[model samples]
Target chain A: MEIPVKTPSHSYAVTIGKGILREALTAQHDLFTKADKIIVLTDENVWTAQQSYFEANFPYIFEVHVMPAGEKCKSFENYNEVQTYLLKQKCTRKSLIIAFGGGAVGDLAGFVAATYMRGIPFIQMPTTILAHDSAVGGKTAINHELGKNMIGAFYQPEAVIFDITFLHSLSEKEVRSGMAEVIKHALISDAQWVEELLEGDHVTELPEDLLANYLAHGIQVKATIVEQDETEQSVRKYLNLGHTYGHAIEAAAGYGRVAHGEAVMIGLIFSLLLSEKFGKVNHQFTKRFLHFAMENGYPFEAVREFTFEQLTEYLLKDKKADYGQLQFVLLETIGQPFVQKVELEQCREIDRQLRALLAEV
Target chain B: MEIPVKTPSHSYAVTIGKGILREALTAQHDLFTKADKIIVLTDENVWTAQQSYFEANFPYIFEVHVMPAGEKCKSFENYNEVQTYLLKQKCTRKSLIIAFGGGAVGDLAGFVAATYMRGIPFIQMPTTILAHDSAVGGKTAINHELGKNMIGAFYQPEAVIFDITFLHSLSEKEVRSGMAEVIKHALISDAQWVEELLEGDHVTELPEDLLANYLAHGIQVKATIVEQDETEQSVRKYLNLGHTYGHAIEAAAGYGRVAHGEAVMIGLIFSLLLSEKFGKVNHQFTKRFLHFAMENGYPFEAVREFTFEQLTEYLLKDKKADYGQLQFVLLETIGQPFVQKVELEQCREIDRQLRALLAEV
Candidate 1:
């Protein structure tokens, strides 16, 4: 599968397929043959699993920087370590960094490569299913003590490799985490896919073709918004459908405890409830959303525990806030999202409804 | 006076004047007027000197982050501190940062601004004569333990305010240190100005009109080269005319002992001698270079102390070097510079010639 990511400098391709990891490596070497050096940045976990495969296949003099696996390691300290490695190894302006793991590795390595020499060529070899969203967007960043992705850049990668063969190693929980982004993609744009996802047996695993189709649909939906507004000047904010609340949940309760996708799953349901109260979507739509999300084993009581004031504080500090007013990706209906500057009172009302929804849960 | 820096995006103006310091306060307000808040990153020296001015003159609310003053302060710890401050202040993407002071403050603050929230608008208000080189270029970075300017980005400023008023209180040594860069500009591109500078008294006071002409000439020469190759692809390497050898002298001597410009002066003389030894220039040309450099009172014996091997190591690790090859910027003739890769043997021969020439001191 091929998807286009729109950015200011150039557009890029996101290629998704099973057992395509080694093939993508070959293709990249062919494309950037003129490059002087090739660097691959992956975590210890990915390196343990696949370093030998890459070393055996790559034609270039490949070097690997093994970062500690997880969100906690995405600090300036790691960024410094990667920079030191590049300098010591004599990586130059002509060098290219291959981000060859999940979102954490991609974000850390991408940011290090982005600012290393004021931007260099980087390719995303996303190994996890969740990265279907992270890999496509040019949003590369690292966490700060203050917030998630507090420091980052909108640096686009040259290409993205979505090899499903790597997905075989993903635990059940990882797959579910990835599904949160997929659901968010459908809610923001594709109504048909949402119907398909909801109709499936929540207990059973998705067939290969069905999963690929969902990933492709999600990519296309995101690609459309990004194509029109690459820098989040307008319509692209729709893609933040559940991130406003999702990021808060992840931040407040220490990251990695609840995977980003898990928090987003809950955030998606909360948005649906808000949508119903705002009269953009009816009770039928809300029921469908809750059924799909609950069947996936998303934690709803966590949302119930969140106080209105807590959410308000997080929203105020959000990047999307305009003149201190929180901007939200409110659903107009299923497969629709719009940006709105919601007042504190309006947000409180939404919070009140969320508490009621939690009582039912 | 205003000079234009042409980037692919848009050509922005750089202003140089007295009392322009006040104008710099609100100059970027239009671009950042809708900002949620404003943050100022400065050093103890600048904060003490100008914090009150900012409070009295600017209509908008602002906060200040004071860092230590010097080249050594551009560290990862400082970057972390700035991020923490911004986070604690609840600075969102809408906040703007103003880097007020000399090169260290600008470089450190610029890197912080470049990576914070991915990136935000930042303005440069340079207060030293040395900043003529640092301020104009979009190169914002921090020094690492292993190398100088090892981590960085090519992020341009929203605007640059070169207030000459600050120079009025500059010490004689500081004025002479800054003249080194001015002399470098003259040596590389303005031969006629070199003759004029040689005829004048040492720049004891840096009178406004004379300093203005010298600054304007240097800015024009630099801006022209930068315009042609904003990212140092080709023509911009000419600006490194003296830096190749100069940085080695500064590093080996222990930083801060020999000011940057003073070291650059020695490097300039060495480059001229190398040009002559390689048969690129006549003895008369080299003699004229020595005459003006010596008359300018820049230290000479510093280059004599370091061996070719030490200098070679610095050049190899220089940010300008592509891969392991040392990119030496040699004068094609006075008023022209060209970059060529030099190996250890070639650099050794050049160092030998430079050592012999320093016998006059």
Candidate 2:
């Protein structure tokens, strides 16, 4: 399956299939023939798992910078290291960057490409399930010591290779972690995907062949919203449905305590309760959504531990805030979310309600 | 005088007049109102000089970050510090960064604004003669540990505030340093300015008003080129006339030993020699150009010290190189400079002739 994202500078094709890595990379060579130098940014694990395959298949004498795996490496230090390496390598504007791993590698490599010589072309070869969400959106950045993705740009890639063969090596936990974003797509826009997740085991235990189906479906939903409002101006804020509370949870817990997807799972549950309070969605819709999210390995303790005050502070610091107000993405039903302009007072009320709910739990 | 640089995003007015600082800032309240927060990125010197004046003139509260003043501060460490300050101040997507100093402050702050939140709007409040060149161009970046401006982006400003009152505080050396760029503008494009320079007194200082007139003219020339090709796709490469050898001189002599303008002056002399060798321009044209440049306080030692091989290596590493070939900006006449695609052997021949010329001097 081919998914293309159209932007002002260029158009990108997201090729979804098994063993498309070699072909997808070959396609990139065709697009950037003038560029002979390639920089492949991938984690140690990914390099260990598949570096040789890429080295053999790639039609150029490229350098692969094997970064330490884990989200912690997505720091300013790492970004500087990559910049130093590129500078030392004598990489020019015509050189290309290949983000040949999961979301972390993608974000790190993509940002390096974005700021290197103003901007350069990079391709996304997403390996993990979590990358389905990350690989599609043009949001590329490294995390600051203070916050996650505090420094980044909405720079799109030249192409995205969603190779399911890479997903075959992912652990069960990694697969579950990636499903959080996929579930997020279903909750925000894909009503049919929600039904499919509830009926089938797509979200629970994603099969390799079903990987393309789920990845394409998730990307399509996110891309459609991103296409209409690329800069998160209006409708695109709906994609932050789980992220508002989820990011707070991730930050407060000191990142890597809970996976991004797990925190998002809890965020979705909290958002559901807020939806019910706002009369946007009923109890039945909330129950069904929570059931699907929880059964797919989301922890209940996530919501119980973090106080509402902590979450509120995190949301307040969110880049999405407009004029000091906390912006909320609430659902009208199970599958339709909208951005709500809520004042500080109303946000405090939501925080109070969340704490009360946690006390009851 | 109002100089406008019309870009795809917005039309910025670069005002050049006496005591325009307070008026220029106060007039921009509408733009500030759209921002979630406002930060004035100024050096310690600028803060001491004009921060109080700005605070008194502006109605709303705006944070002023006093950075260490100098070319040394244009590094990733300072860039991070600015990011930290912006984050701590609760800056959001709507935040506006006001760079209120010279070229270093403008480049560092503008780059910070560009990279922060993908990009935020920034206004340029230039306080030096050198900034006439830096202010109009959208190029914003910080120096990497390894190289000058190794990391950055092509981010334009919301407006440019060029208050001539600021020039009253500038030293004679600073004034002469900036005059080199104006001379470059004339050498590259304007025939009339070349005639004016030739007619002017050798070793004679420019009157305050005439300096402003020269800067305004220089800015207009650069602004037109930038407007045609913002990313230096073609015509904007003309602006790099002296920069090819200038960068080499700066790097070899250990930056700050020679002023940027002084180095550019030497580069200009070498360029003329190269032009004469390439049959691009006559000896009379070269001599006249050289005379006017020397009259303006351009240093001769920059060209005297380095071997041709050293300069060639630096040129090879230049951002303007295409497919291993160094592009030299050679003069056609007194006011006509064109980019010449020169190979390494051509570089050797020019260097041999330049050495002979320098020996005679």
Candidate 3:
């Protein structure tokens, strides 16, 4: 499946399918032909699991820079190290960077490409289901000591080549984590898509073809939203649907303690509650969504780990926070998402409602 | 005088005049009005020299961050400190950054603004004549250990406020350094402009109004080129007329030993010689230009400090370089420029010619 993404700055395609890595990469012969060198930036976990597969499929000669697995690779020190390596390698502006891991690797590599020699072309070769949404968006960043992805750029890639064959190695927890974003895409775009997902098999047990379809659908919704607002000036804020609260919990959990998508899944419930007050969303749907989440085991139990005040510390630090007020993406009904400014006092009330509801269930 | 810069990414004006800092800053009332907070990033030298004047004329409240003077402010450590400071101050994407210094400060602050929160609005308040070139172009960067400007972004500013009042504090060497780029702007765009500058008073002693006119003219030339090619893909390479050889020498001489514009002046002489060989430019004109540079005390003596072999390492690292061939921007004639690939053997021959010419003179 080839989904084209057109933004104000540039346009590229997200080519996604099972076992499509070699063919998809070959399709971008023009980008590779111009590259003076190709550097693959991946992580330890991905390299350990799929190095042979990647080596066999990727047709071009490239240098590989294996970084620490997970969020550790997104640190300032790691970012600088990668830059120093590029400088040492004499990577020119035409040197292409292959972001060949999950969201963390893509963010770090994309940002590396964005700033190296003031900017260079890079291709996103996402290896995880979670990257379906992130790989298509031009948002690339590294974590600051103060916040996650506080330092980055809206640097688009030359292309995103997704080979779902890599998904075979993802643990069950990783699948559950990745599916939260897929569910997010459904909630924000189509009511029918949301119903289908809600009634589907457990996230980890999804049939292979159905999983690919869901991932493609998610990328299309993200691409459409990104095309309309590449820099998040307006409708792009809708994509932040659960990230504001999600990032807060993820941050409050001390980063890596809770996976990103799991926190976002919990934040999704919080938005549904707020949507009930601000939009046409009803409590019944919100409850049904919560029950589905409980069945799939999204780790909402992490919510009980920190108080609202602890989470509030991270919330106010959100990029979307305006002079301390919270900005949230909430649903009007099942699909339509909108930005709404919510007060801290009201947020606390929602926290109470979420805990009570979680306790009852 | 207002010179507007229109790049594909953004459009803003360069407001240049004597003692016009306050008025120029105020003219962009919409920018300030939208900013939640204003943080001025300047070096100690600029803040100490112009703080009272800046404070008195400035129409708004702002936090000032005085960094160590010169290129030190553009280090990775300083970049991190600035991000931490902004985070501690509770700044958001709505906050504005004011880059108030020479090229180093502008590069650092512009890059800080470019990466902070994935980017924020920034205005250039350049305090030196050299900035007349750096301020208009949105090529923001910081120095990496291995190379100058290896880490950066092509982030355009909201506006540029050029107050000639700040130039009064510049040293004679600084003025000489700044005029090299002004001379370059003339060399690459208009033959008449080059003749005007060559026949004018010594760089440090030019009449105030005339200097301002020259600076404005230089900015206009830059704006025209940037409007055509914002990212230096084609016509913008013309602006790099003296930079390739200049940067190598600047690097070989250990950066601060040779001022940027002075090195560029020497590089301009080198290009003229290359132009005589490759283009229609006459040797007599090259000699005349070399005479003008020597008379202005542009430090042609610095050329004999390093051998061609010593500078070769940095030359190959040039961002415009492809594979291993050196890419140079040479004039077809004064005011007409094009890029050419020069082999190492040819480069060595030119280096010998430049040395022998510098020796005989």
Candidate 4:
């Protein structure tokens, strides 16, 4: 199935299916033909697991650069190395880049494509369920020693071709991480979807068809929000419902340890607790959501590893933090998100409440 | 005097006048008031010369980062260092950047602002005559080891404040290098302007008022082209009239050895020679332009420093080179520019002709 994403700068489609890599790429014949060279940027893990399948199915001749797996791929040093590789390969503005791993690979490759020769065309061929949220959006970046995604651009891809066959190699932890974004998408847009998910089977054990449906739904929710605000100047902030606090935990854990979605799941609960005070959300709903997260094995213990003061440093460094005050997207109701400014003192109070609730649950 | 630059992605004005820094910056009160913090990115040479003037006129408190002088500021190392500086300074998305130098500083700072935290608002305060062209067009970049400006973005500044008083510190070579772009603007847009320049006094010795007038005229020419083709997809290629061969020589001379416009001046002669063969341009006009350049001292000797075979490597690496064919922007007549694809064999012939003509002159 093809979903269209329209933004002010450029518009493209996101095609999702199982075993559709060859067909989706072939459909983009004109885009490929226009490129003088084709480069595939993936990681060691993805390339090792899917190289044979990819080579057999991909129609065009291309060069592949397998980078370090996980957050290491998003480092500034690796970013420079990929650029050097492109330069060595003589890739130009007319060249095309294929981001063929999970979120890390997509983010790094997308940023490289965005800055190479001012800008160039790239397509996201996301290999993990987590990429359903990242690959569809135009937020391309690499991590800084000081922060994650501290440098980047909102450069859109020519197209996003998500081939779920590549997801067969993913570990359960990866699946769990990917599902948190899917859940976040549901919470922000559809209370009915949230209710279904609350009563659904283990997130890691979802049937193939149901999983694809969820991924597409998540992409759609993200696409609609991105269409309204490409640069996160307004409505796009709604999509960051769990990220402000989530990134703090992820950063404190030295990245790749707690996993992005696991940290986000923890952050989702924090936002829920905050929402109970700032919005129409109820305490019973927040506790029920925490129970759902706990049952799904999202590693809430990671939150206990860092003191609120430890997280506070990373929290204030958030890109969304305006003038040293924390900005968060809170749910007025399950399906309605709004931006609110919270002071450190109030955030500390919420932190205390979250810790107490975690002890009770 | 303000010349408005309107591109599809962004629109701003180039406010040009002597000692207008105070008024121009004050007029942008709203932009300043919105920024949580302000940063000034400059080079040692520029800061050393104009820090007092800038500090006196600037109405806001801003942290300044003084980098190495010249093309050193555009190095990959410097780019990374600047990013680290901003992160260390605790700059957020609402922070503003001031690019307060010539082409290199502006290009580096602009690209920094374009990519830092996805992007942030920036203002261009040009400190030299050469920046009259670079600062207005929204072309921001940094040099890669493989090529010049191989990494960058098409990000426009909030406004360009051209305070002509800053030009007082430029050396004779700087003025000559800057005038070449002015001549290029005239060659590609106004026949009368070209005639006036050819008959006028040496470029470095122009009266202050006339120099400012030429800079404004050059900016106007650039602004119009940028408005039509912001991303260099079409008419904007015309602005690269002399850059193909110019970049080759500039790269061969190791970037800073021969200034940008000095190399462009040599490229202009090469393009005119090519135009004589491919367009309505005459051989006499090419030599006449060469004589004017000789009288103004544009360093044609840099062309002889490297063989045609040596320059060929950089030529094929040109961003304008399509599928290995050299793309040249030639004049049908003065004030009329068009794109043409030339083979390596034809380029070698033109190189020979340029050598013979230089020897004769």
Per-residue lDDT tens digits of candidate 4, residues A87-114?
9998888999999989999999999999
Residue A190 of model 2, lDDT score: 64
lDDT winner between candidates 2 and 4? 4
lDDT agreement of model 3 with the native: 0.92
**Model 4 interface CAPRI class:** high
lDDT tens string, model 1, B41-112?
A: 889977777666556655677788889888756887887888899889888777888888888899988888
lDDT of 1: 0.78
Which CAPRI category fits model 3?
A: high
Give the TM-score of chain B in candidate 2. 0.94
State the TM-score, rounded to 2 decimals, of chain A in model 4. 0.99
lDDT for each of the candidates? 0.78, 0.80, 0.92, 0.94
Colliding pairs, model 1 = A152-B118
Q: Each candidate's TM vs. the true structure?
A: 0.94, 0.94, 0.99, 0.99
Which of candidates 1 and 4 is the stronger one according to TM-score? 4
Q: Is the docking of candidate 1 incorrect, acceptable, medium or high quality?
A: medium
Best by lDDT: 4
Task: Residues B1-361, candidate 2: write the lDDT tens digits.
Answer: 8888876544687877777777877788789788767888999887777766666666666788889988766978889998998888888889888898888999999888878878888999888888888878888888886778778888889889888777666776677777788888988887777888778865237777787788889989988888788887788888888888888888888887887877788778778878887646777777776766666667775776877777766777788876566888877776676788887887777767766765664
Candidate 3 has a TM-score of 0.99
In model 1, which regions exceed 4 Å deviation? A30-32, A52-56, A201-204, A277-279, B9-11, B24-27, B49-60, B187-195, B198-201, B204-206, B277-280
Candidate 4 local lDDT, B278-314, one digit each (tens):
9999999998999999988889989889999999998
lDDT of 1 by residue, A170-267 (tens): 87788888988988998888678788788885622788877877887888888787788766779989988888777777666678877888888877
The candidates' DockQ values read: 0.59, 0.65, 0.88, 0.88
Ordered list by DockQ, greatest first: 4, 3, 2, 1
The interface root-mean-square deviation of each model, in the order shown, is: 1.5, 1.4, 0.7, 0.6
TM-score of 4: 0.99
